[model samples]
Target: MKYFFFMLAAAPLSVCCQTLVHAQVISKSTQQAIPFATVGLVKQNNGTTTDEIGSFKIQCRSIEDSIIISAVGFKTARVAVSVVLSARKIELEENLVLLEEVSISWRNKAKPTTLNDFVHCPTNYYSVGLGTYRQVAQRFLAPRASMRLQSIRLCKMAGKATFRVRVYAMDSITGMPSTDLLSKELLINSSDKNVYIDLQENIVLPDRDFFIAVEWLFISSNEFRVKAKIDRQKISYSNYAPRLSFKKLTGIPTQNNCRMLNFNGSWQKPENYDSNHVFMIAAELGSQ
Candidate 1:
């Protein structure tokens, strides 16, 4: 039997997309670092998060490309890559926007398929891998209207895992996830093996198709807050990149198989993956 190793990687070419830069996002008036900030390249899908203390390094195509920084309670920040690189630190003002009304159907009928891969995670490396990042986006359809995303259900490997989840409408041409539904994305701190996290967003949905995206914030380092899990019995994965278990499908997928990727910096999608991950990621939706 042929074995497949699940990992995402990018080329080592010395191109504009390979240029790396670092920045620290903090409160402008208070001079305090903002933790869990979403920093990324504008006009592109490539992005990453700041550590608990508000520090991060990102790969950019060039100093000409724009960089965007956004946090839960602060106003979004956008600046030129050259300007941010020159400044080394960014300060965003806080915005106290109220959470929207939440509506989630707690019925088991609304529960998504529970898939599991029983794979173990490596405990050494900080993030998912040395030069890679892991993302799981599953294709799903909203059955009813008056839906607001309430929570995401998943199984944690061991200790606490901090990740960011985003809901997107699928693209029309490529069939991938479209733009981030909300210009701003929320951060999540998951800490249990199998539990539902109350996602604090009041997003209304229609009876249409969508995708649930999960980005693992596994940075490999003792200097920052560690969110890595461990397991001895299952197949061990590298610490450099996150290894979320997948729910193996016995039959072929009707639409897109749960999208899996191991990317090194730039945005690259897998060509032909027929299997779904045991990420067991589910969302709670309720009507208004």
Candidate 2:
């Protein structure tokens, strides 16, 4: 897993001095409107904070201005004034936990010298089936040890109105779905949705890996057309090695109601554990 820090930019204010835009920011998780979240104009200093109901009123001179909304522990969002005026509400997802920093030099030295020294040789699996629309699959591989799975985020794209997601594991060699792991369903709106799906399972030989499969259903009843993306990050420490991996998928949609996507990979560690050493692998999939 590779970790990277990102900085968000604010939106710009309008120059017309007419037409006020009222915007609301809500948490996708708690659903109890968020208060005191920061909302500001990009490239300008003008800003305001949400009130008790996670709502704010801004005076926009024109619809061309952009607005930047942010809160501690949440990912910052930038929206155009036009979008703010058109939509009655907005939701934001929480930021995934940042992986603990580890120097690269230590990891390079800790690379397993032989296949037998590898610790957690866990395999990760992911699959997507679109009803005559699209297809996708994904997987992650790593040596089992102590690790933390951070935020799992879903972003809805254009033409996609609604969708469903599930997380599960499977048998390593047979590729058969396993019910031993917990699974959850995720509902995504136009705004971002963040779900926490952390597991503390120990992966040794015989078990081989944890498989997570996501199933997506596009709601076409409302003539809804949309796409979605998934972002995941994990940090773990093994007795012999430390590793981090981040995976992201974007522009996923049902193309013909029969599309599918898949991912498969693995991680290896040395016999001796070292905290200073960290190996990272980033797996990503997105629209063309």
Candidate 3:
């Protein structure tokens, strides 16, 4: 659904009394903390992330919103808002098959540039919500027939966060992302400099160009701002109005291929932004 963003402090009239729940998510088998888990209102496209210790405070908009907690390799736990608000700790069973780690080296004829090669410096940044996304075109020519996307990197500017990574096949008409290459969500934790989300899937690159998108599952807090030459051109990373500033340039087709599902419920380039300030994120590829 198309919707406008609102400030964190602003509440809708439907809010009579909100449910404030403090909870922690951890792995059931290992008893370890599961940080950056997606916890929030189900079907409402609203949520928050657990901190480093797996602790989070969920503010339910209303009792009608079902609360669900999910992670990359864990089973999703869904419960009523009231049921969650009263619980202390929730444990999620692992959905992964744990085997001894093995390393394999594959011989390739050509080695392409690293992920750092495609990424540019960030001119702006934005927070993500349900359906909110930042997209970058994948135009790299790889020698391999198929490769594994091991991890994705996001430059963390603020709070601990998590999002789903999606790789879509290019549309024949608009050259935009048309078909989903993935069946499940690839959850990413943005708290670590070394943090990367494992794709757990194969990227078949046979004259295949695509779009990589980061769709927000949950963002914890808003902590920064950006000001421009004019007062009306101010920019900030806030909920309901999360935005990325365009890098200033004279004229070019654009080395930076980026766009946003902006607050106005439209997919357009950033207003007054020169260079597409998609983000400063990296992706690492592994052997097929």
Number of the top TM-score candidate: 1
TM-score (C-alpha, index-matched) for candidate 2 = 0.29
User: How do all models score by TM-score?
Assistant: 0.61, 0.29, 0.52
Regions of candidate 1 where Cα sits further than 4 Å from its true position: 1-20, 28-31, 40-48, 58-70, 73-78, 93-127, 133-135, 148-150, 171-186, 199-203, 221-242, 257-269, 275-278, 285-288
| lDDT for each residue of candidate 1 in 166-212, tens digit (9 for 90 to 100) | 67776667667665564345444444445455555556654356677
Write model 2 residue lDDT over 1-288, tens digit each, in one string: 222211112112234357787877887776668665556655333455566578887665557778777654567787887898888677888766421211111112112211112223222212111111111222333344222222232222223233333233444554544332322223333321222222222122223233333333321221321233225533221110011122332355311211122111111221232222221122121111
Error of 3 at 54 (Å): 1.9
- Order the candidates by lDDT, highest first: 1, 3, 2
Off by over 4 Å in 2: 1-16, 97-288
- Decoy 1 TM-score against native: 0.61
Report the poorest 10 consecutive residues by lDDT, candidate 1.
Answer: 221-230
**Model 3 lDDT at residue 53:** 88
Candidate 2: how many backbone clashes? 52
